[model samples]
Target: MCTVCGCGDGEVKVHGHKHHSHDHSHTHSHSHDDGLHFGDGAAGVSVPGYSQERLIKIETDILAKNDRYAELNRAKLAAQEVFAVNLVSSPGSGKTTLLCKTIEALGGQPLAVIEGDQQTQNDADRIRATGAPAIQVNTGKGCHLDGHMVGHAIEHLTLSHGSLLFIENVGNLVCPASFDLGEDCKVAILSVTEGEDKPLKYPDMFTAARLAILNKIDLAPHCDVDLDLYTANLRRVNPTIEILNLSARTGEGMSEWITWLRTNLAQKQLQGAAE
Candidate 1:
């Protein structure tokens, strides 16, 4: 259970299927029975609980520990010159499909993926079919991927230096907003089939994201989503957030998306070199 979001208490398994020489991918599941219970107010101030100050302290302590882990992960990535991106969205937002398309577009590029889900290695399998290495981090009941979990997930897979690591977060926007997985950017995906007012409804996710991908544009004609209105709503929460409209199915506007990714990656490499 993630103390920050209280998503779930399910088990997390890192599955790395061997596909290459650098691939340490193996089929093994490890259960973590840590005593940290963030859910049910495990902060120890329950029922006729302790003072509000004590409650606040517990929350702060939890976040602080997570932050420390995040910082450590960031340092490790920096040491390897890996540009990590965190993908966050609601369920069925077409994030996995879009990633597969992106991987194909980035053919031959050094890329790795960290797939986060409550269960199933399905997404990781899809990514592997694209000829890229991927690690599946089953978050069990956890709604979001915290830094500590990500750090452990990285340990199981071998990511290339100067490569891009895509961390596909669990399919929930709210809880993921607060947890930092040491990503260089947070890209939120909003499908056209969903309400155009989603940005306003889920302000935390929208505001936390650096880019918002308005996916499924191929179905825009059949859907009721208003592109202009959606953009306006996104701006209301995040004035500087970049927005991209693309349909992973039709490959329309995909060049722009790929170009954006390459540009960011180049910038990251330059920064790493300078450092």
Candidate 2:
């Protein structure tokens, strides 16, 4: 189980094939005090029989291993000159709709998608309908996609050179913030209906993201959302994070989002050429 979030160490499947199992064995005493304090440790998370120090060590070890796999995935993407973006958001953020629109806008562009969800290939089916290649990774009880999972998924994709790859992560803001999937940058999607205090509520997610997209902006006025306050809160969490306001349904600010993608893709290609 994830020591930080307590998510299960469940079986991960990539496109219906069982990839592997996250069976982490822990040797801790079963006895515990009746008055349990799980937050008193330095790690701020306490397992039943594990001490705070042990929890910190376990978390550190897990992240360190993930980082190693992330480096491997990064190297693989670099070799193909792929500009990868990890799209992260909460449930009902309209990420899949925006992605479909993005695929339509970037017509004939060499691009693909890796869809992550707890269950179902529904989003992957949507992406494939755009005539682009896509892979679905079902994380049964897992809350987020780790670098190792992404590495395995990439093996099934035939990515073009100098292509754009989007990894639509599972709809959870907390755990995805800590896992790196070898993407060039993380893009956080927030809908106006979700409220402006999302950044403050999930500061780690906004802080880890390089760009923030305020999706469903067309509904802002109707929802009585203050766009200015949303931007302010995002800036408070990540002072240098780039913000974009767009509505996938109305195509209000989609052109800017497409431009951002092309600009980054060009930079990645240029970097590859220089190397």
Candidate 3:
């Protein structure tokens, strides 16, 4: 079990109580650049309700700005008629391998990939081998991909009408769930090696995802991952989330995944034209 599983966990056990101080539900906005706003908690002072209410208003304004920008990004992508899918998962969760094989499965019809990583262009190199236009954004210390980065990436991307864009996000589950990268959908990729409880553990990711690809199915015989339980947990978080199981290395379950993309891409084009 994870160390932060429940109240019985190590950190909570140390205090003989399980009450967490607070989970800061912060969503980044175009307005807020939080340098440091020290509250009264550190000084053991009780602040007035009015001050706290004002702070809450500021937060609401910030989130409203972010929602506006997200809508703008969405409009821009829809106008360009691109089906941008954000790939999110842990560091070694087959994101790059899946991108490599996904491009290959695409057979180069007009696909571009924006690769996000802390460092290196290794994934971009893999993408290049498939003859797709790939741009690497080295976030250096960032934890996730956001709309600003994707909006910037589009300036360099050689996309045409009906081009498929894939933004393989920086490998972090939590922060990425809050940022909208102008994508038509957020695609969460979970591998069998990550285990069945992942969806329940990372409900934010599962909840945000419209579709999920359960990779590494070919390794099922060699591993003890319960596929049924995994699907059940995922469905619990997001009943409408389309699930696809595949292994990129062995080319297992590639056709279904590809077909799903093609179907979505066509539908998006149809919708864009109808508008």
Each prediction's total of clashing residue pairs, residues at least 3 apart in sequence or on different chains, is: 3, 0, 0
Q: Which lDDT tens digits does candidate 1 get at residues 1-275? A: 45544444655677775563333322322113333344324434353435555545555676677778899999999888888999999999999999999999998889889999888889999998988888888776678888888888888778788888999999997878878888898999999998888999889899999999999999988876689998999999999999999999999989999898888888888898998
User: For each candidate, what TM-score against the reference?
Assistant: 0.89, 0.90, 0.80
lDDT of 2 by residue, 15-115 (tens): 72223332222222111233232321354665668777766656676777788889999999999999999999999999999999999999999987989
The top-ranked prediction according to TM-score is 2
Q: What's the lDDT of the predicted structure labeled candidate 3?
A: 0.72
The local distance difference test score of each candidate is 0.82, 0.84, 0.72
Candidate 2, residue 22: lDDT:
27
Cα misplacement distance, residue 101 of candidate 3 (Å): 0.5
Say what the RMSD of model 3 is. 11.4
Return the lDDT, model 3, position 110: 87
Indicate the residue-level lDDT of 187 in model 3.
93
Candidate 1: residue pairs that collide: 8-141, 10-141, 16-25
Residues forming the 10-long window of minimal summed lDDT in candidate 3 = 9-18
For each of the candidates, the C-alpha root-mean-square deviation to the true structure, in angstroms, is 3.8, 5.4, 11.4
Q: Which stretches of candidate 1 lie over 4 Å from their true place?
A: 20-47
**TM-score of candidate 3 versus the correct structure, residues matched by position:** 0.80
